[model samples]
Target: MSRQHTSGDLRADRRYAYAEACLAEGDAAGAAEMAEQALDLAPRFAPAWLLLGRAREALHAAGGRETDLQGALRAYANALDLDPEDVLGSRLRLAQLGVGDALAAISPAYVRALFDGYAARFERHLVGELGYRGPTMLCASIDALAGAGRRFARVLDLGCGTGLMGATLEGRFDRLAGVDLSPAMLAKAEARGLYHRLVAGELTGFLAGEAAASADLVVAADVFIYLGDLRPALAAIARVLGPDGLAAFTVQSHDGAGIVIGPDGRYAHADAEVLAAADAAGLSLRSLTPAAIRRQNGLGVPGRIAVLSPGLA
Candidate 1:
């Protein structure tokens, strides 16, 4: 169902639809006026609030009006308050505006909703348009550390969206399991039949339910960008890995001391933050090398592929 339909008012829905059409036609002023009317009729409509916020943001971009930006912020805050799960991703917008602290992690509801909507076009857009090579590059990083043709008895693919990583490591593991937040993504992965099992849940929560030392290898390709603080997930990965197990993942890289939420709504981590988190989680960093995970805005995004093993106490 469309978000506008949830308002339960035919008139409000018509206004909202008109607002969306105006926005799509680059008529921000018209959209804003119509959205305001929609809000007047359905004051608590979260999607209308989001549309108003976006229209105000567009106007601010064109006119450079501080008041418009502030208005956008208030609209977004109202939407977030009405939908704390943040299915509309207002928190990311707030972070991009530099008005809110980078969230420790993106809300699962947001991720799930985003991927569910993008599932059908994800691979084409990511691989063909964005030139995403995260899975292949991460696998190469693992092979460089573990030696080519190294095999594992059990492997876990964290945030295993569409099983891209699983496809890369198909014959390299005796057993493979996957976990992801989006049911739509998991359904695609299941269709690939590369994983022995595919589960749908948040990464850390899924890891918490697994047996200690159960996985011989864990891989997260282009997954950590949604996470600001890496400690919790790192610790959970450590707990789930066997003594000889290794964990490998890719993260957007930055030069700052900690994590930063980029304007693109992804988290970029400094090397210091990643090292500290791995050390705290009792994981030995075997490799941390510069790489390009994907392309954004016609440029390669700088990133790091880190491979880690269980550290002795």
Candidate 2:
């Protein structure tokens, strides 16, 4: 951190600069080699960690070492931890890993904050680049429920990034509230002129704090993936629903009967698991439909939308 000038500093500088240039030109291994040489001369050169991160990423991207991806992330994380604001290093690692921009980033603290950052351009990147289907399909499923005359005077939109779901359901509800964890995404949703109120909080806890048995209809579009086990969330939803209250939700599904979290931290739940959770919560699954998130290369990933109502009702 001192930025001191030394006798061998000139040699170290040249090699470090060469490593970066090689990385920029797509020679990741060459860049890594140059960086090692520079580090040999100047053991404390912080910039070289960044160079090494990019090199390892390129190696990972080329499928040069799938087995080493975890190790690569650790190396990149070490560099970032040392220099929290290492822009180049952070950019390469997070971008290649594809963790920050998606729903996985949504949370209770203004859960929309991360989504809001991507809100202005969320749809474009989702549909065009990353093949996002959770949000759109969630909207569609909620609309179907409304069409079945499951209208409400008070509605809650959980994880309402940019108010997309609120916009789709506004016609069916006299009052609409959108709650999310990110302030940034809420800003965009607020600007959309859809929801009557916007709040920042975690999905289940926020839902729990509201006036008891208040919401007649609830829609959680693509929110369940963030939850590994659905029982806790399902229990909360049941609390907010009155005797006749109805809820519609979306969940990624696998072919079998279990739940698993992918490397992305998004949980994919099976039909039986989803059903069991609903049952345990004293809610009856009125409908379960197979759906596709979006299509890629003629194959669509499996997902489901479930409509639930309290069993005692």
Candidate 3:
């Protein structure tokens, strides 16, 4: 799950590769068979188990068979047991299927593993393919609120994947610091030379470790989608932000009252919940604008970009 050799058995590895190919080719039955063969040889291989689960999930989606769904659940459960850290995102799959805790927060390991693997082609794919405009949108929002020629003494970029957000805020901040869980992503960000400080750590933990009232602006562009509950992050942001500091972020939004885990393994938060979290965290919600965060399957994904400041009331 950590991008290491997943299977020690050569035959099992081959079978797993074939299973992946089969799934890619839309041969769910063949994929399942191949994954089963791999698991028979290496029962403890988490990747194979995950593949089996995916194959079964595909089958269940097509056939609507309870048996297939149950099989998928078992396979994912086994994978989760083998790797509790959920680097492969077994928990997300379970939640997506509505079989487990629907509001479960994505595992940090999963996010780290995901971005680490994507770090190489991340900007190209996300911005070019998916049409991601989170960084640009956030920067515009900040500039609009701060007015012309406004500059920040200190800025924090939460989940600063490949320094995209830092790059967007280039001339606006005197000092730019970024934090990400993936070392690979941090390496990519470091290569950009946009950030003054680059930290490899979880966003919440990094925020908590910073001195209180230290940051003039804290930004988390498209970062909250991986986190179902925003209260903790909001509180940490509030603690680290100066009295007049602003916290800007974005999230995949839903019409529901709270949160929902989508099939794509991302969390979508409702406007009500966002406001509630801001209130509870002692932050004032300055704005929540509906925007298209990215494109998925040729359509824009519904999301909200929000800005918050220390509460005056």
* lDDT winner: 1
Candidate 1's C-alpha runs over 4 A off are 1-5
lDDT of 1 by residue, 91-180 (tens): 888777877767543778888898998999999999999999998998888999889979999999999999999999988999999999
Off by over 4 Å in 3: 1-4
lDDT tens string, model 2, 36-149? 788788766656665676687787778769654654565566655655444323433454476344322322322233354567687787667657666556656655755644
Q: Model 3, range 56-173, lDDT digits (tens) per residue? A: 9999999999999999999999999999999888988888877777666488888998999999999999999999999889877777787755799999999998998888787988
By TM-score, how accurate is candidate 1?
0.95
Cα lDDT of candidate 3 equals: 0.90
Q: What order do candidates take by TM-score, descending?
A: 3, 1, 2
How does model 3 score by TM-score?
A: 0.97
Kindly give the number of clashing pairs for every candidate: 0, 11, 0
Best by the TM-score measure? 3
- The pairs that clash in candidate 1 are none
